[model samples]
Target: MAEWIYEDGIGEARAALIEDGVIVAAEIEADDDGIAAGTIAEGRLVKITVPGRRGLVRLDGGEEVQIEPLPRGVTEGGRLVVEIRRAALPEPGRAKLALARQASPEAGIAQGPTLIERLHASGDAVRRLMAHEADALEAAGWSELLEEARTGEVAFPGGGLRLSLTPAMTLIDVDGWLDPAALSIAGAEAAARMIVRHGIGGSIGIDLPTAGSKAARQAAAEAVDTIVPQPFERTAVNGFGFLQIVRRRLRASLPERLQGDPLGSAARALLRRAERTPGSGMRTISSHPGVIGRIADRPDWQAELARRIGAPIALRPDARLAISGGHVDAENP
Candidate 1:
């Protein structure tokens, strides 16, 4: 059969297939949504079946249809019958970047087997995997991470909805068996939204606080949809009193990959030396991004180290801390 082509910026466009001056099938292309993401073209095939006919008919309704063959000649019985249907579209999923490649042992990029190459090869899989992983982490849950770190367990205020979050700040709490709580739909929704925006990656457990009232549970579930700025996957409440949420993990957490390790190492060394010196009257402390129920439970600098450093030592909840010019204050506590 002969093929036809037509391009329109509107909804998906397709043209009926023509063979020997007779219509047979239609071809389809996805239309542009007119967004910055650009138009998507998904290949589609629709059969345009005509009664008693052995071919198809060409339709201009932006769809494809195939037909069957019939007796020769044109008439009311010869008129082409068309039924347009859409074909399957490609599934949308994660995307990632490429990575650098490793060199072989014998044929190294350097001169012979001993020299070095000015550049490095790339690994598309590694790059792509890293990129997708980072994205997934960011969308997972940020506030949940923070909440868990702070209190060991944070209840799922959304009632049943899951949370999404950015990469850095996560809010979550410790986990334990608990009854679901009774909360208004509005309250549940607010909690859900907050959870998604602040908590991206890491583990998060939401305790509903009580269970028993169907209205409360329903309200919480509705809140999840209300708070979400975007759609989510793997977000569902379990039979237990917990709301199970798995957001995409983005890149490494702020405390994990970004913070300069050298500086932290140096600070710890300074503290250690101070601690051993004795009578230094100095103290130092460092903290990651969590606030605990007790001061002692919070990470602290050894008294000896603080004395050697020539001042009080401390770590803040925000993970950044320092001492200079007499006073040191930061986000950590």
Candidate 2:
């Protein structure tokens, strides 16, 4: 049976769906993910950007979001309850605001369900992991999966996929030593698996090896269908071997979270390592200066880590080390 292995790490909550001892899907919910979808809150209409179609709202917490289908009688400065449809997405230069719509007053103000709650709702067996227990997550290639998201590189049997995130959509290029027909089939399947694993949604463009025959193109498209379960729409493979897919996007994908905020991701990863470090007295975390700075900026996270491990935590900055090259050392007192 497929199971979800869950860990409540210091700064993030992680879950991995394991089937046959391999991770098929994964999710990471950081503490800073603002105004998650399904959240119901009261906010004041701040500005009417699109007249009656859309407007901006300022929540009680001072975060602004875009709301659509403005109520007929509600004008600027009117207070109303809103339900978040999509959480804010972090991008390279600018972040997208959360999207919401007016909600009934009966909905009441409530926070969104957490990562663990959503997993439990899936009807799958969930195993909550403790830090002191054997590292089941690591054994399931959690670190390797994370590296793939950070770099957007996935290697399969016959070829590899290079995924690039664009403002319009995610573009995937397949390349390998195999022949065009075989490579197209293999690459399509591999790309599909990566999309599900990374929780990637929205628009996607897959560029496979150009197939000369219509039958070859159909085979490649079928390969993708077999891997990715539906609720998505896809265009038929064209003569040039290009296929496009559209999926419902409610939040940022794993790649976006890791790539958009490298220092925060690295800092949280380092804390996870520190929590699991054995024979700890004063655990020292050594990493790039930027990562160390990120951790230092959040003293609450450090205190939480120290509390969980029952040991003091120290930060050691090494400018020469790569961002993801951080390590944890437990002092023997």
Candidate 3:
């Protein structure tokens, strides 16, 4: 049976779905950041892009969503109610939000169980962790996963694949190795695991070396189906060894979230460091200036981390440090 491990930190809340003692899914949320998605709000229509394609709706709290299927009879500067289907990812500025449905003006704040809560309510045996489950998350080289997710360059057992993000789809280029059939099979399996590990979804295109037979191509495509989760559509490998797959996208993929912000990923890395450290008094995570700035901005997160670790948490901004390179050290109280 699968067990759910949940950790409620001072500033961050994390949940992991562990099946057979291996973590299959993980989620994290910060207290300082407002819930990104699954919220309904009242807003005012600000602008309409074209006649019926998309419209900008500003919520009462000043957030805005580019609502699609443009609401009927809605004009400029009109009262609008919408449910935020997708939350804006954390970026330099406002994130583009996708609205799902029209809501009534009387709808209050969207309420729903958190990731961990939802998992518990699903009738699974849930276990609450007194501390962060870094060990479980660290399985199979955590650093490598984070780095790969950030770079979108992944290597298979005998080959490699580079994933490129386009506005329309994620294009993957597979190379290395001599056997086309073996390479295609390897690429398909690796890509499927990477997609799940990196939380990749939506449209995907894989370009493999031209195979000799349609049977070989079909076999490769089947490998992907066997590994990847359901509710996704895939096309058979073409003559040129091209396969297109589409999956439902819910949240920002790890690659998409950390593409431009290495320090953001670094900050989370430091949190994992704190989690792994055994003894702690005043735990200080010295990081790059940008990373420090982000952590400092979230006092609630700092407090939460401190409380969870039973120590004072300090974030030191060292301009000399690289974003991805930092040390988590403990000081005597």
**Leading candidate by lDDT:** 2
Model 2 lDDT per residue over 269-311, tens place: 9999888888859999999999999999999999999899888
Q: For every model shown, what is its TM-score relative to the native structure?
A: 0.28, 0.95, 0.85
Off by over 4 Å in 1: 1-194, 202-204, 253-333
lDDT (C-alpha) at residue 27 in model 3:
58
Writing each residue's lDDT as its tens digit, candidate 1 over 1-333 gives: 343322221122222223354322222232211111111222122332354453333333342223333324433323332221212112123111111111222431221110011001211111111211232222333223333322323354343333322333333322233343444343444445445433233444444444466666666666666664444543444434355454543222222211212233233323323333333332333433322112233234344333334456554343353321112232222
**TM-score: which is higher, 1 or 3?**
3
> lDDT of all predictions, in order shown?
0.32, 0.92, 0.72
**Local error of candidate 1 at 141, Å?**
19
- By TM-score, rank the candidates, best first: 2, 3, 1
Candidate 2's TM-score reads 0.95
User: Model 3: how far is 138 from its true place, Å?
Assistant: 2.0
| Candidate no. 1 TM-score | 0.28
Give the Cα RMSD of candidate 1.
25.4
